[model samples]
Target chain A: MNILAQLPVIPIILPLVTAPLAMLMPSEKMGGRAPFVFATFVVWAVFAACAGLLHSVATTGPISYHLGDWAPPIGIEYRIDLANALVLTLVSGIAALVFPFSYESIRSEIDRRQISYFYAALLICMTGLLGVTITGDAFNVFVFLEISSLSTYALVAMGADKDRRALTASFNYLVMGTIGATFFVIGLGLLYQATGTLNMADLKIQLAGDKNRMVEAGFAFIVVGMGLKAAMFPMHLWMPNAYAYAPSAVSAFIAATSTKVAVYVIIRFIYTVIGADFSFAPAAFAWLIAPLAIAGMFFASGVAIFQDDVKRMLAYSSVGQIGYMLFGVSFGTEPGLAASLVHLFNHGLMKGALFMAAACVMLRVGSHNCSAYAGLARRMPFTAGAFIVSGLSLIGVPLTVGFISKWQLLAAAFDSGRAWAGFLIVASSFLAVIYVGRVIELMVLKPAPADAPEIKEAPLSMLVPMLILVAANVYFGLHTELTVDLSERAAHALMGAGR
Target chain B: MDILNFFAERYNYWIFITLMMMGLYIVISRGNLIKKLIGLNVFQTSVFIYYISIGKIAGGTAPIYVAGDMESRAHGGGHGAENGGGHSAPGADGADALPGKDALGAGALHADDMPHGDFELAGNDLATLTGNAQGAHAPALHAAPDAGAPIAGAPDSSGANDILAAPALKIEEHAIAAADAVKEVAHQAGDVVYSNPLPHVLILTAIVVGIATTAVGLALVVRIREAYGTIEEDELESADNVAEFGAARAQEAVA
Candidate 1:
């Protein structure tokens, strides 16, 4: 047996094992950095495993890893194709990069005794996301989604030492996220009742006929449930507070991966499992997602410009960016789905960098308020520089990752003959400019308070990850072939129009 | 009768929806943190009920095994005598009643009755035939209508066989054939053939997920109570707003 055939499961199993081990390892005697260092190594190992899995998938077609040697319908299967492999890589890759940065941020934000627990939760969260991406079973999706969400709630609550509001923020997220997960379970249950199978492939084959009410209801429930998790449009009430109040590392990690993973689940269900030819396809994209995405793009960006806290501002801006990704999906064309996939990957890079920058600032400034950014450019030039690069990327400035995604998305709209969508895509970037501009103005132009303490540059540990992420934003922007090609393959896989 | 059939076929689904709605209503309407989590559990359990309900077969029992013929052969002379006695039960008698009859006898109830509503065979026929518990009625069973009059209200033939096999094992062990018992088990297995096992497996995973969510949710609530001095959702919001305004004032001062 080729040992490498089992590579797809390693990413999930690594973290699953590491998380409990991290919890068992004492944090006090080894210093707060022990769990951090171990987790960083474990996450990087998961990233390497994902990279190996992706490499094998690219070469040998899809790899199906059956748990306990049972076949697909009888046992849990981990199927890795180009689409989910790319997502797996993104989640593990981002977790690996963010964990190193989390050390100092968690130290500053979380309680001394709870730091090891925080690392454990973060590792479990990563494992959950990886599992969600890799599993071939429909119910496993719900299971992994909850696993990640539950850990994420705890991770967010770890910020209670920094701000008491983190408590309420985590609670709200728990309520909303649990509801979403339950809705997802109900949807999966309905599908299981209708089709009598839990394997995603088996579900697809069983649901091939004209829309049955149970299947349609299952579809609607799943979309709405995943939308809530993705923070899609009006369902995004839980996101701002959760992102804004969480420990900066938690914010950086979750803001980058959690909702993106949710969006991936939506795409997987809509395009792959249910098939794009389902009767509800047009109405779902047109009447539901299309208009909502447009509304979100405008509504969230408008709300974002008025936010006082820079982290909350970015959180709202993240919601609007999600609108852009959904708008790409709404077109229901190959280019549209490709654009959505591209933006999904590109946006992760940009958001990770931006949130890391915010964390770097929070490290020195002791606050997330935009007012605290006064003369930050002069105070911490490197971090301020990283923030500007990522902020500009968020605004879709030329030669940045955000611009590449926006360009592809607009091109998709144009090719699909939706001139209004193209126009709106461009117009929304103007709103991005306004919100991002406000942060830049505060950092660069506002006078420093005379009573403000001398704030040193963020520790090298934090800066290295932020700078690497910022570099990725610029590097991936200039060299678009890697992300673009992978996304096209993923989109084609979704469309079922190509091998 | 039509309404009863509809309710019989669909009552599980109705209960599922009702429980689902009650759970969702509880989650949405409750303000207390613990209540909301309880509501979530109820909502999730309703789904579990829905999944488990889908796997039910009208006359089927739990997905398990009953002894087959090969195993009966291993039982030697007792197995052969049991086989001889069992197949001689009413409606099951034929020249080759020992082996093939058991296979055909269980299905003989409904399969032979092609007419939709006209067929009428009393439930007591099966009771007396399989059990021979009413030793007094053994003559009546032998004198009863031949294969002409079908067994009415047998509902499911496999279910009838299940009822046939259990008591016959003790009271009239030799009356029913060993192969018939296997046939009874096989018939029961056939009704179960269409019942899905995938949902049950998935629900096992889902239950674990539910417990995990409950644990983490309660942990978060405990932390929230520690920080805000309240587990009430409404009270927590006011505390959050107070902090929000404080930050806003701080911003205004800098500006």
Candidate 2:
């Protein structure tokens, strides 16, 4: 047995184990920097494992690691299909990039004594998202989800060191996130009651064509639950304030991974566990998911246009971006699902780069207000340039990741005979251009106030990782082989699993 | 008459739904942060109860193995599996055991071509170990408990002295032999109605997650109280609003 077969669980366990060890490191001397350095090393290693996992899952059908040598249908299995592997790589890869950037990002937002705890919480959050993505059992998803949510609450609260409002933001998120998680568990219970299995594969076998009300109720509960976590429209009240008030590093990392993983869960449940062939699937996809998705895209992008706090604006934009993904899922066709999956990866790259750029600006400017960016292009040229490029990408400009997502989504919509949705998508994207354009106007076109404080470029450690993410945004935008091929394969795995 | 019968037949579900709605009501309708966390706990606890009750085999005992089956193996969390990852026997990564093929490429995943990676690595009978849990329900289990009640609020603590069971039920680690032994003993007895151990184990994990969430939520509340001098949502909201458009926001933060 090669270690490659054993690779699926490493992404979860390595961080799960490191988080505690990181906390125990002495608070004196290099111990102050030890947590950050250690976290970076571990996250990069996880990225390697996740990349390897994707390659292996691509080659070996799917990799299922039975926890403790126990066989599945019984043991808690870590299953890695192409969809999961792609998401795992995206999450870990973003985390790996964000960790290095946090060296400077957190320096301003957190106190020295709390630095270790911050890194610890970040690692645990990483462990949780990875676990949620990799697990094959339905209930295991809940366990890992809560692990992430709890840590996320604490991570957000750590920002109280910078702004007292972060405490309230974290508390609000806690209440909402817990409710969402509980709803998920309730759904799991109903599914278990109907099928007598918590193993997802086993549940699928049992649920293939059941017209069972109990199972249907479970599906509704799961969608709403995951929808709340995914920041589905109308339920996204917590996101803006939470992202706005959070430490920059926390905002960037969570923005790039958390909601995307939740959306993946929603897709997994709709297509895989419940099966698209189920009686409820078509109406739910068309009326429920698609409409909500389109509304969120327009509604949120409109709200984002007015936000003075740039981070919060990005957060609102995140809600809007999620709409395109859901819009793709609404089609319930292979190409449509592939579009969502592709956008899923591309959005993570775009947001990770954008938020990191925001962090760089925050470090230098001490503000996230649009007015704060006046003449920022002259003062902090490289950071402003990164922001401009990523902002353009967010607006779906050509030769950027955002353009790829929009192109695929539009194609999927047209193919599925939902040409109206394709139009709506393009229309919503212009809303993106409005908000993105406003920020670009402040950063580039306007001049700095005469009394404006001098600002320096972000420290090299932060700039390197931030620039790397920006590079990935462009590289993947041009290089469709990796993202598009993997996404299509991931979509196939998800579409096939239900059958 | 039909409506009454519907409620009567699923009274356990009635309890589940009532508890769920009550908890949800409090969470949405309340203003205090601490109260909201309490509501969340109630909501989560209801789910635990719901799951436990579902795994309720009528007249079921706790999931410990019966007179023939070795019941002690369950204390190690029912599945009695290793702690995942670190304990795996090395070369477990030998991807060769899993038949290599691109999923969307040449070979479509047939049941026959399915890679039994774990079983093959352990050199166990891949079929018996399970790909067996396929096609859903196995035969009606014999009247017997399999093992473990780690969930504090578990409904099926049958014959247990306390939460999920006693110290005698504790088994830190179970070997492959333990699983075989339990199966053999279960086959012999064939008469005990045992709770499926899975939900018990799952609820146990959920309970821990619940506790951690409560702890974190309460911790945030404490910080909120310190920072804003209040924990009520209205008070916090007013404070944030004042900060949002006020120049005093910058001055106070500096102070």
Backbone clashes, candidate 2: 21
Which residue pairs in candidate 1 collide?
B83-B177, B83-B178, B85-B174, B85-B175, B85-B176, B86-B175, B86-B176, B86-B177, B87-B177, B121-B152
Per-residue accuracy of model 2 over A1-499 as CA lDDT, tens digit each: 7876677788998999999988877545664789888988999999999998888888878888899887767567888888888899999999999998898778787877888889999999999999999999888898889889888998998888889988888888988888888888888878876765677886787787678677888999898889889999978988998999899999999999999999999988887788888898998987898889989999999999988889999999999999989989889999999999999998998888888888888888888878788988998988988998888888899899889988998888899898898899999999999999998898888999889988788899988988888888899889999989988988887888755
- Considering just chain B, what TM-score does every model have? 0.50, 0.53
For model 2, what is the error of residue A363's alpha carbon versus the real structure, in angstroms, after optimal superposition? 0.8
Per-residue lDDT of candidate 1, residues B132-240 (tens digit) = 2212111111111234322222334454344333310111222243435433433432322122234565678888888878888888788777777898877676666
> Which regions of candidate 1 fall more than 4 Å away from where they truly are?
A497-499, B1-9, B68-185, B188-195, B246-255
Candidate 2 error regions (>4 Å): B68-190, B246-255
**Residue A112 displacement in candidate 2 (angstroms):** 1.2
Error of 2 at B53 (Å): 1.4
Report candidate 1's fraction of native contacts. 0.55
